[model samples]
Target: MDVQPGPEREDSHVDSDVSASTPLRVALLGAGVVGGAVARHLTERADDMAARVGAPLALVGIAVRRPGRDRSDLGVDPSLVTTDAEQLVTRADLVVEVIGGIEPARSLILRAMEHGASVVTANKALLAEDGPRLYAAAAEHRVDLYYEAAVAGAIPLLRPLRESLAGDEVRKVLGIVNGTTNYVLDKMDTSGAGFEDAVEQAQALGYAEADPTADVEGFDAAAKAAILASLAFHTRVSGSDVHREGITDVTPADVAAAREMDCVVKLLSICERTDAGVSVRVHPAMIPRSHPLAGVRDAFNAVFVEADAAGQLMFYGRGAGGEPTASAVLGDLVAVARHRVGGGLGPGESSYADLPILPMGDAQTRYYVSLDVADRSGVLAKVAAAFAEHNVSIETVRQRMVPDERDGDRHDVGEATGNSNARANLVIVTHAAPDAALSATVESLRTLDVVRGVNSVMRVEGS
Candidate 1:
């Protein structure tokens, strides 16, 4: 595949003149999948990158947990790998960190910046949790700290928010950021697989981790949402600030209900600027089937941004894997290399707008509720009354009888056998309402003796 240059490539180059004898030295941390890909990228595109930056770039060193591990897939000299990460940081003019999570990655990048080296990273968790500190350290050292691969692997989201829409007001950034959960949900919708079954299939296909709680429980998407929210709103948003709802609770019945309503279930990461403040959340949401993000299927990611000038912009691509993420990391590497060779840097700290993170209760959105109720009179009226009491307006309501197998052959045996025969399914789609009110309504509905259970409660987006 032909690699495309990022948005930063279109900008005019710096005027700094560097001696042709000086080769740009790059240090890579974490010789894992993405780091390996970066090493390969540096080797494969050496001539093009060198010509663009006006100097040959060299991978001087690589830091890894196990220095003796074979990295033939990267197509680089195995002798370059070392376990001494601290020593590697000091020897390079530029550093690329693909060592995800917090701790060492954070300290190593800071040390590199302190050593007068520009840094690029794909660590979204570190950026979301300690972005301000890293930004401060980079500013203190007067060096570049770029993280384009942090949020949506191959998609150019960070650069667009930082540059393309710099002048425009970005009011909202809603996305399907986690490919693991998205793939599971897509499989559940298309193949009629249950949540656990879909997740198992995703794991076998390498789309989900063995311990899939991080992706399925919304932790991964929440981290990315926090990072994207901080960038879009120019505020300090952490992983704890995001309201997360996993896809673990979504069943095949819920997927069927969504299809019946001309929608699809997706794990959505929503970041919106409200009158109160900025709201950030990651949840399984029901999006209209025709929405741009709804079409993003297995192992793919897409971010939908709403800005004053740009209106609606959608960025879609592979959200994970070694090569795709390396593309983003390398793009930042080239930009930072150009800046270094020109004796300049990219934009400085961006946390000027300190927007408060709104509580989940204050964040408003439509909801989809599925309940199992006794097949008796006044059940629908009682459920509707509970929503009415909470001031939740209904957009659509669907109810179907589940016949007992002992009675006779049902209209659809495949569908009716899934749920209890004694109970019926009542699916309701409500208009926008306060989260507190919706919770209260759900609580009230649960109190009804005729209501067997609250099957599922999901948010509705892109209506």
Candidate 2:
């Protein structure tokens, strides 16, 4: 696996003496995919890791719920497996946590830090929810708490934002942070598959879970957005602060409409600095094919960051899977191990800016709205009036009659225009408007007698 190390060190703490430095005792929690891979890689690269850190890295023990479950496949020593996770964490100089969730993982990490063990974790949900308290605990104990795997899998994102771009002002962070949603959307774009069919395909391919609520409902990406926004803006943003919209509501019509405008529908986790404050949101939006993010397909991930000094930078790679995610875990493990050997701490939390999260209502973006309405003269004027009423300025409006076969379900009110007894598809693309105003316009359109239904409404993003 290709794993990129963090920024280089200025301290010349390199020691080549094999027997001089004390071996760092490493404890691993969770013998699942990431943890097992970390152990295997640690064992395979023990010699190399010892040389790099100036001390031998020993896997003292692995904490697991089922110690009896055969882990011989991972090459883990059976004697190292233990059920007492608390005891296991206390005996180590450094702990690598891959077990997800908020409870035992959080408590165990805090306890490990108190025992003078620097920690590396890949738990994004926990970090987004209770990061401040963990940071404070690590600071109090003078132990490092590094979590490079919490976002973007193996992309090496957090360190660059925390270190390399520390001097630059990061203006925006836009990413396709969820792999499941990306796969589903890619199917919808390429195969012309509906939401259910695309999701089924993703499941069959093992890209999504049986219960894909976290990925499909946008919760996963929203949590990642919170982490990204906090790092980019130096704010303590949580998942609840982000405005989330899932692809569950996306229809085939939405996908076809994107094609009409030379765009593709993607679920994006976006974080930006606004004049009011910081705005973070996750939603399905249309991006032009020419945009860098549009080409990111399948389970792949990409993040576009715009900084004042550095201009624009794009980080692209495989964002998920156990190996890719384990790669990130290993990177953090190595960095934290080096810091432990040097008796120093890595970068702690830097939420000094403390910017407030802006409300979604105030967020401004363009919109694409498609409506099925009666093919009549006054109907177009009435629909145009709806936009004007909500203070939404329209950039373009195209009206066309639906084919007779497609219009079978649509009822024709009367004959007013040349295409007498046919229902029309009204496509309206708006300029940048407040989210609240665009939402209001859509609601008002539904109330109009001429409009049968609002087929699709998607935000338009990117250049």
TM-score of each: 0.91, 0.92
The candidate 1 region of ten consecutive residues with least summed lDDT is: 2-11
Report the CA-based lDDT of candidate 2 relative to the real structure.
Answer: 0.85
| RMSD of candidate 1 to true structure, Å | 5.7
| Lowest lDDT block of 10, candidate 2 | 1-10
Compare the candidates by TM-score and give the number of the best one.
Answer: 2
TM-score of 1: 0.91
lDDT leader: 2
